[model samples]
Target: MNSPLPTAWLEIDLSAIQNNYRELCRISGAKVAAVVKANAYGHGLVEVAQAVLEAGGEWLAVARFEEAEQLRKNWIMAPVLVLGYTPPEQVVEAAKENIRLTLFDTQTAIRYSAQTSQRGMTVKVHIKVNTGMNRLGIAPQDAVEFTRWVSGLPGIEVEGVFTHFARADEPAADTTDRQIRIFDEVLASLRSVGIQPKLFHASNSAAVFNYPQAAYDMVRCGIALYGLHPSPETLLPATFRPALTLKTRLTSIRELDAGEGVGYNYRYYTSKKERIGTIAIGYADGFRRVMGNKVLVNGVEVPVVGSVCMDQCMISLDGIQGVQVGDEVVLIGKSGGLQRTVEDVAKEWGTVNYEVVCGMADRLTRRFIHSNDKKG
Candidate 1:
């Protein structure tokens, strides 16, 4: 017996991810670290990480220790960096697995040192300087001092020093340049005291194109790795192809006469005789209620005509011809000459592309497509 078909599914092209990694590498002219945090921004963490590694990417950065641990569990031995906080208790396990951590707080550094020292192991750490982000990181004025203090610890190795851009995605904003100047000053301070770490990086995806000068030793490619522009103002070249496509099949269709109501609370009403379609996708599948406005059927744009439910939604097939039950409906991806991108969906949802993709529910089955697969 075969397993039941998924109502909605995500098709992830691993080849597209690899192509994007190579493009980022060519553009940045630096070692590109693939940011696979947030489950590779909801593209399947292990699968995306493996794809990047196959594409000559050596480093994998995640937002938390658990993500790094998951990578390790999958036997992915790439140099993994936890870009966010790692609990004091997990420092030892992190060290044992050879995971690099972002160090900013003195108390956390002290705990890391103690844990590593007690275990007779040394853990590599990247010092994060708060170059105007005002989020995580040591104050710029105190970065040198903190680096010196942390360097003196018995089991902690200051392997890298980095900062994050606050507004690199905005081309007209001067915040990126200001942050670059501040970071350069911090690097100069560290070097003056002979505390130059092996790596110095400050470029995120947007900065990779907007501020190439800030691409120090390595560049962190997150959204771009998935072929997404960092922001509306910072567009990537046309060559970067999006790796994921959302699709579902129409399950049922019904003819509704004029004055008929549809969906919960009767939010939609038929103005004329219309063919309504019910697809096997809804908010539970990451198609939010607000997105009930449009989808693609037979390469034609159709209007979603009702309040989206938890497991289903309704679309008006009023003039579309030859669209039958079980015909493929595209929520995101190209259909004929028409294309719906994450950015397009983001615009409809009043959010960013990152949230639109990352918010996809885990229940939605992911089917990876690797066109270049030669392992067989």
Candidate 2:
């Protein structure tokens, strides 16, 4: 829609996105609230949000007030609930924009109500219960009181009750069951206080796949919508495709002498005189400097002979040839016959798949490509 994009772009198959959403829906049999936060995990939120909705997603979720604003400005008419904290000052704008806020305490809702009513508008709010994640959300015991207090406040709607799971993605998790038990307890507590929120939800991508019962009225799925299983145990009958691919061009190729040191600290050295190519990507591009001295190419993985630099990293390609200047090098995403999934890299990095996708979002210049347009 704007100017011509660069040749090296993160090609997103919108059709794949749609298929994955539908597949996720099928597997979970729950309404999908595709999480498009973190710029849609670096897949370009506006474009990915549009694609998801077009493919039959009914609700959207973001983590920040400004992200919701950007989506609203882009004409995303779905119900968008911000899953993170929002300050009192921004409550009125959240109301005016029809964005929702997550309430971890009664004061946030009360403050928001005061601010929103002064502006002659109301904002829908979800009361978050901290079961065991120990991150955000109010304590389980306090959730009901907070919900009741917020529900009765002017210019605020207690539209939902939710919680975060600590290990829903893990196989045979005892912890998530406890979290859900707590969630149900809070939901019942809300009813006791006569605060019947319109929506009851607590499932993320992991819960959607592994724990279906957690899908109350809606399920918020981030990584799953982008063609990734949040955990290996996440059961899905439908095919999902990874939406983002990070590719860079080879800048140069050179030879290294046998036994010569390579990279910082000499982490890798040549056993023999070998050919090497420096690719135009490095830790600066979110390619983890720790991926040090390791490269995957030509369906055969190789080692990185040195420390990763800021703007660039060198890959050893001894037997691998036919790679000249500008040969496509896939640091992440799919490239040629050789492919490395985000899950593959995340495990190597001692991180989650969510982190890997978010990693790509943080590292590269994202390009959006809408591959399908069948509307809902």
Using TM-score as the measure, the top candidate is: 1
List lDDT for all candidates, in order.
0.92, 0.79
Q: Provide the clash count, candidate 1.
A: 0
After the best TM-score superposition of candidate 1, give how far the Cα of residue 69 lies from its true spot, in angstroms.
Answer: 0.7
Query: What tens-digit string does per-residue lDDT give for candidate 2 at 1-376?
Result: 4224342346667778888889878877878889999989878889889988888788899999889999999898788999999899988888888888888876676688889888778889888889999999889888787777777788988888888888888958699888888888888877786778888888888888677889998888888788887777774445777777777777888898998887678877889998988887777666778854355565566666577887777888889957787777776665456777777787788887778667663445666655555455
Clash number for every model?
0, 2
Q: Write one digit per residue (lDDT tens) for candidate 1, span 1-376.
A: 1125767999899999999999999999999999999989989999999999988989999999999999999999999999998888898888889899999999999899998998789999999999989889999999999999999998999999999999999979998999999999999988999998989999999999999999999999899999998999999899898999999999999999999999998999998998999999989988999735689998889888879999999999988888788988999998989999999899999999999999988988898887567456
For candidate 2, the per-residue lDDT at 65 reads 87
The estimated TM-scores of all candidates read: 0.97, 0.90
**Top model number, lDDT:** 1
